[model samples]
Target chain A: MTTTDLAQSPAIPRDGDGPVFREPWEAAAFAMAVRLHERGLFTWKEWAATLSEEIAAAQDRGDPDHGDTYYRHWLAALERLVAAKGAVGPAEMTARRDAWDRAVRATPHGQPILLANDPRSCAHRP
Target chain B: MGAHHDHDHDHEERWSEVELRVKALESLLTEKGLVDPAALEVLIQTYETKVGPRNGAQVVARAWSDPAYKARLLEDATAAIAELGFTGRQGEDMVVVENTEAVHNLVVCTLCSCYPWPVLGLPPAWYKAAPYRARAVREPRAVLAEFGVAVPEEREVRVWDSTAELRYLVLPQRPPGTEGLDEGALAELVTRDSMIGVGEPLPPAGAAA
Candidate 1:
């Protein structure tokens, strides 16, 4: 089904339906959305729209599980907020992620290491 | 949405093989040093493109703003977390254990790192395998101590054994001096390990340093 289908379905709650997290982290995210909405950072409608769009894209890519689909959407929502607010720039974020991948690759199998923090480095912790 | 069927149960074995294949490929690339540069580039882009850290940050933010929600979170974690707006499919079942002066909770899937990926995004490599899973649960205090978290001897340490069916995430205590901070600011204090219960959330801004 399309994201619009997911969004419009009565199975999903509308705004002011109270929290609807199935996972603890999802609840955590819902609470954050509430706080942000209260502070005028973004409306619940906007967040829902963004998340729905994310799910739709995942469906297009052949992911059928709505719950699994939401995690990626959740991450995208955060990235949008941080970027929109200039918490960190796209370039800096990309560089740090690249560094993390490199560290994981360099470490032996079964041993993953995160790069040491560098003041001059472009990556900031998420 | 659909009725449960016996065939769905059989799908598990197939997916496990798929997981194994992916891991094997990843390991092979790492061993060849072929994965470092490209993989890192791809890794960063993947998170930026496919996975984001917002979910984990949200949990941290909520605990800071609402005392009642936080209390519920520490108690019947599954229902409390569902109260927000996340659940289902990849979300799976979850349990949240609290860390306190008298008791500390740590989570690890010893057989395989069956993390709550829907909420936490991807599981870090260390979280998915034998060494860490086996060691962390067995000697939690020692492990935390190595991570520079010092738990007192008087506190009862509780290690939650994670399985494929039930995943666990640690609900760290809120940091001090964060009173009155907005949600975004509070989210900044959350760390990956804090949610995993390896380390506590950092003290607000400069409180610790």
Candidate 2:
């Protein structure tokens, strides 16, 4: 705690003493991590380690840590921990991610994007 | 069976890659039964609405108005905060440090953002960033200056590094001219930054108006 890292710290996005969520995804990512933790998927200790590792990796890769990508690292950590526990495979995650991308594109304006909206998921449905 | 629209890119075109990834992860987790969307919603609702600085504010107010409660808070923060109904994850262990005329206390997580979520909600973005984490312990006075706090030369600054096992909440010095204020009014003066030791509570002048 005494050692000085001297890296950049971002200003908090404050809405009168309340933490701000710039996007719905940010809140969702945060909630997902907490929910997973509550479900006993990974200890908070493990999650903290994974997140610290992710930030360190990004810092090594020249991420300024400007604060916006904090949750990106958070999501990455969650995914890594979840995958490491064998709860979800990387390949399946990639496949599901693609399905979601297609589903988002398929969903009409102001409509909820469902997995069924993805043509691939629909075609693969038994 | 599909309803095709050539102009359907609008929904995701505005979305960032990380955003899509979050949605994808949530959907995938839900499908696998590893996540319950409703449960996720409840957690989000709790953080957004139920838990936050107000909880810590109430504790600070009570501590300010009541010596016995403050004694319990400083001695056993975990049970004391739970006594006020703020016991949960990220707050299983608690330490309440007092700020006095001679000593000012500041908290940061040098390893990561380990905060008392039950009391203060989420850690602010800056609290989690590398700069604050690295600098707070090293150059606390300068950091406090950045947060618009100026610690006099006579006062000592003590920095607390929070961890997953333990978290801290600073019980800021109760403001002067507030002896007559009730707990609720006193709570209103307890800002989140004050409890983090970055800023002081609202002065009575502001609270009066």
Candidate 3:
């Protein structure tokens, strides 16, 4: 999916007041939260409650790295809210993830390879 | 998705060949008992989740939103990035390149994927392998073209060769039409590939509406 689609989707709070991410996508999620709140899509209180539930579920699953655990929960929460809001559908997102997974599996070491030079592909130019 | 299935098949074939070579090496090392499977698993997890992409993201975001910060980034990327609270092993030294209209920068550690993990979270899969490193420097424009990134012939493309000691990340220019955006909002526009200079920060969909 396009970055725009990802951005317009609802904010997914990472579990609790856990460690803020050091990466851009994590920051993007945070930014979305702020934007969503400003627009009144959801209040900070609702966000907190949803996130707490997510963290609790992760704890039940016996995941370690409490803070990191929350982050994943936060991503999940956002994915759910965004899908509910119709910014994007779960099926489409799953398809994208599946495509990425396929690419990873096909690579020699189960890694993803950058394909920037296929002659028949219009996306590839010199 | 089916439209790309044929291309995917080709990728799968190439990947299988490469995987075999890597598995062979890993198997040899495992047989020698040089690397414990459990320890290897932990190491991979630590690097992927904790060290790599997270670090890279902070650096790219700062460069996008802060002019003075960007200057500091290019001047002393390692220390500047560390200021965001990410540092230590695998990070080492880092160089930040600014992408401008007259010039564009792309980084590839052709020898191997020697990236600044403290700044960028994890090196994307394609980055750590051979084809990208070998081809990026030699035919960067061609490589970027595949990512749907176009560069004018007039603009000079400067490809940085990464080394074990020094790692590089691109600081793509902030997209137009995002005036008056807060730092956080601007940061949202920055993506992994944009930070690598292979793509532009996409415009916010709401902005058009």
Which scores greater on lDDT, model 2 or model 3? 2
Regions more than 4 Å wrong, model 3: A1-126, B1-42, B52-54
lDDT of 2 by residue, A1-126 (tens): 232433434443333554557677888988888888888999988999999899889888998675667888888898899899988778888887787788777667788777787878755488
- Tens digits of lDDT, candidate 3, B1-209: 33555553444344333233233323333444444445555544565456544456556766667778888988998888888887754466778888889999998766434566666654554554345655677678767876778999999999998765677878887777777777667677776777677777768657662
The regions of model 1 sitting more than 4 angstroms off are A1-126, B1-53
Per-residue lDDT of A99 in model 3: 40
Q: What is the lDDT of residue B21 in candidate 1?
A: 25
Tens-place lDDT digits, model 2, residues B90-168: 9998999999999999999887788999999987878877778877887898789878899999999999999878899
Q: What DockQ results for candidate 1?
A: 0.02
Q: What lDDT, from 0 to 1, does candidate 1 have? A: 0.55
Question: Between prediction 1 and prediction 2, which has the larger TM-score?
Answer: 2
Error of 1 at B78 (Å): 3.6
Leading candidate by DockQ: 2
Candidate topping TM-score: 2
Better of 2 and 3 by TM-score: 2
lDDT of 1 by residue, B109-179 (tens): 55434566555765654554334555576567666775667888998878887664577877777777878
Per-residue lDDT of candidate 1, residues A1-126 (tens digit): 455643443221112112233344433333333344445666544654565555456556775432433544555564466456554345655555554454444334344343542223345445
Badly placed stretches (over 4 Å) of model 2 are A1-19, A108-111, A123-126, B1-15, B206-209
